[model samples]
Target: MKAAVAAILAGMVIAGGVSAQTAAPAVKEDFKPSSLNQPGQQFPQVNSQGYARFRIVAPDAQAVKVSLGLGGRGGTVLAKGADGIWTGTSEGPLDEGFHYYHLTVDGGTFNDPGTLNYFGSTRWESGIEIPANDAEFYALKSVPHGNVSQVLFPSPSTGAQRRAFVYTPPGYDAAAGTRYPVLYLQHGWGEDETAWSNQGHANLIMDNLIAAGKTRPFIIVMTYGMTNDARPGTLPNFDVKPFETVLVKELIPYIDGHFRTLSDRGHRAMAGLSMGGFETKAIAPKNLDTFAYIGLLSGGTFSLEDVNGTPGYKDKVKLTFVSFGSRELEGNRAGPPGQPRADPRVNAEALKGAGYNSAFYVSPNTGHEFLTWRRSLYQLAPLLFRD
Candidate 1:
């Protein structure tokens, strides 16, 4: 049970969510405001080296600390200056991509007033972006865009209206007779349907890929994965039945009925990140008739024996896509007590050797953060529905 809980929590903070490092070279002078900062807010800045510098104004506070740092400091302590502004820089560089952080001002938790807040770690957190080398793939480009519309569908099983965001590719409505494939994407634990678009930039990634003719246009659906029930102390006995019913029995039918979708199994796919990836592994493989392509991003890995045990998976499944950040490979890869750690890259190779359309990817210098997922989606989108 201890190992099980460890495995479950690993998805939440793989390598400690932008883990700290030891000493580093002298801090460079090329600091600029983060791209995610609010209008006219310039205190939270990121340098080219991924080191974050924070400035918080607290005239009378005893101590102000930003919950982003390196070298096991747990956070960066700001020193108050004559101007009453507390400022400090991270000990070393942070991981490239999006990270959720907060402020500890005189022992009180507060969100940074300078940047946008994103839902993470079960609450709204201040988001910071360390510019990535391949950020262009998910950047807002001058290309055709997709519409991410909020959709509320009835859920008789749950006796409430569940909400989902559907991303219809550009020119979807303009092309009336044309139909597109659908990928039922999910968010990680403590996140809602908004994470994919707001943080992960799913729509923009797809737009860039489609405009470049790198991928076929498809509809992407994102919804709450019902993971709130799997909170601390309850995760060991977590069940996927509630969400499976809402998705397979309720949501899928509504999407097909309302949108111009290729409603067959071959044209459908499911993928998620972290705990969302775990949910995909739980729900997609068991219902192979509903999902043809499966993607797990930093969720977990699947072995040959596991696939062989799943009924009808050999004949019904099309693609098994698995990916993780390079940093995650250095962290805990263990499974529940007796189960051996299955190297995901090796498993991908094994699946390929057995005539399965398996693909694996690793984001350079990242952990289980949004950058890895963004890159994974960029790579996975081009390979989806290639037939």
Candidate 2:
């Protein structure tokens, strides 16, 4: 997510909506098929330095461009060769972690045939992974794995059945009567329930955390954040009441009745990223009785006034975790040109000074992207439900 994006997205989600090149060292010859590629397909490869090289076959095309790399440039333009194949390398190394991109082939947009698809920009686009140095924390090791299951719960407010993904920790089924804490995680705008599981790998992160005994086992519930109402860049006009009703009145009841959750505010948590973060900042403070732990990952902030203004924030909110990408704080202005940027660090400090349970974190060397949110979750998880 860009700073401008986070600015325009501050109001509501409303349903639906880069690394520097290394020194003159030789490009490591260890490029391999992107982890996101389909089976037996290769071409979109990333070297150890995070440079992505692409080869797209277009026999009868005029132009081919990969919509990634070099945040400023219009993306990498591949040159046609004698063999009718178009190939190119990113102008510079990309930031580590998953990115959604598309191919602009001869003025027509399409997905790269090699890589798997991820839902972003309200569509399924090609995804690529530039391995992160700290990827091991979310890697699938020999540790016990959890299962992510899809569920359909009825929502009287929406008058339709809504879908959500549930993550049951390893041994959750066998343990039978053991109840676990719950985290109601939401995705950014232009994403749905699958974003956290497929792109963010929430299950893997939790599994690794639990296997190492770094954090207690918990259930994660993810659903479409009801952001389809307003168009992008018009989030301020979006209404959050409809979505809040679905979550508070309908979905929580369904999860409590079906899953072996602790079913209490003390064991329940809520967090989101980007527009999802905006949602969290909006709902969590107002409904402290429902969510004991609140986390805002590159979403927004809870100022001293926010805690002071809310009814039960001081005693009810067990944890107030605020985080952002180190890069997201680069500029003096955190919002648009006119709006004054609210300093999250100051707010966090003030909250703590006032005897509130507040924690602040910054993801190193990342932007408003999944790498930031992933690290935020890893840090926030350990602090949640401690009471």
Candidate 3:
């Protein structure tokens, strides 16, 4: 899946707020500092309508533009003000949830000095938050939170120790002899292990779900999807076996042995977004004994043909959760090039028709952004680790 995340993000970042912003009332004046902003900064703000206003202080710079405001024509261009600060509003309203962006100052790319940084496109990019109506699901609440710890495991395949974030649910320590199911989550292309917790809020989502009694308690393990082997736009020749070996051969055993997990086929699952989704689709069906549940978020679809071809998919697979933002499925364009163009909805329906536990979901009024994946995880978590 090397560069696959980059490809998906390239196409996704540009499709922002295209259909969302329409002929409407004036942009609301209720702009508040982005939730992702640094503690004391107030430059980048988001209004109730999801319109983002940016303020950059670059007294000596000739030009400044925000890479995340209204895609296509070089994002939103900022005008120099009398105060020597650059300011601009997004050309259109952006989708709700987190968006990765950067500032172009005097023809050079740099992170927005105001907002917090997130790893995307293989670099630290500025991030902004547009509050979602269902944000409470992933929001930090008064409930007990899960622990996200970094683990260094020996990976003989790569000849080095690999790092992964392990999310052990709250009360994990109390249940001394109780073993839990495991979900091996993968981050998209160009992104590493941090994407799930840092950007997607996987831990928070799980905490809220477990707290509310909406889903069964399960451990979530996140790691890099091994996408750096190839550069962006070179996904055509990407190989899944290398990453599959790392995940199945090394990560699974290590987790089962070290953590109190139900190390069985029925208790394990795999899921990802974009390139990570692609990885889940490739690895799960073939390794039925390893993963019983599969999910793809704005990733690719698994046709009935794919299910029939995989030897034990029907018997071992428990759920096939397919999801995308309503915008990504516009004109039935789900998967990118190098994969089949079958609409995920149609494929999902086909799976259900063929007696598979397939669930399809769409995030309304959004594109291929984090909002899409966040909702996907929320919808998927409840269906996983179920016997």
Best by lDDT: 1
Model 3 scores a C-alpha lDDT of: 0.84
TM-score on alpha carbons, each prediction? 0.95, 0.94, 0.94
**Relative to the true structure, how large is the alpha-carbon lDDT of every model?**
0.86, 0.83, 0.84
Among all windows of ten consecutive residues in candidate 2, which has the lowest summed lDDT? 8-17
Tens digits of per-residue lDDT for model 2 on 1-387? 244345736422111105544564566778888999999999799898888889999989999998885652478899999999999988777778878889999899999999899987788989888899999988888989989999999998899999999999999989998998999999988788899999898899999998888898999999999886556666666677898999989999999999999998999999998878878888888788899999988888888877888888888889899898776776643466566687889989999999998999998777767788888889988887675
**Best of the two (1, 3) by lDDT:** 1
Candidate 1 per-residue lDDT, tens place, 9-92, comes to 654555324445555678898999999999999869989888899998889899998887662247888899998989998877
What digit string (tens of lDDT, one per residue) describes model 3 on residues 51-88?
89999998889999888755434688999988899999
TM-score attained by model 1: 0.95
> Per-residue error at 288 for model 2, in Å?
1.4
If the candidates were sorted by their lDDT against the true structure, best first, what order would they fall in? Answer: 1, 3, 2
* Winner by TM-score between candidate 3 and candidate 2: 3
- Residue runs of model 1 more than 4 Å from their true location after superposition: 1-5, 15-23, 71-73, 331-340
Backbone clashes under 3 angstroms, per model? 0, 8, 0
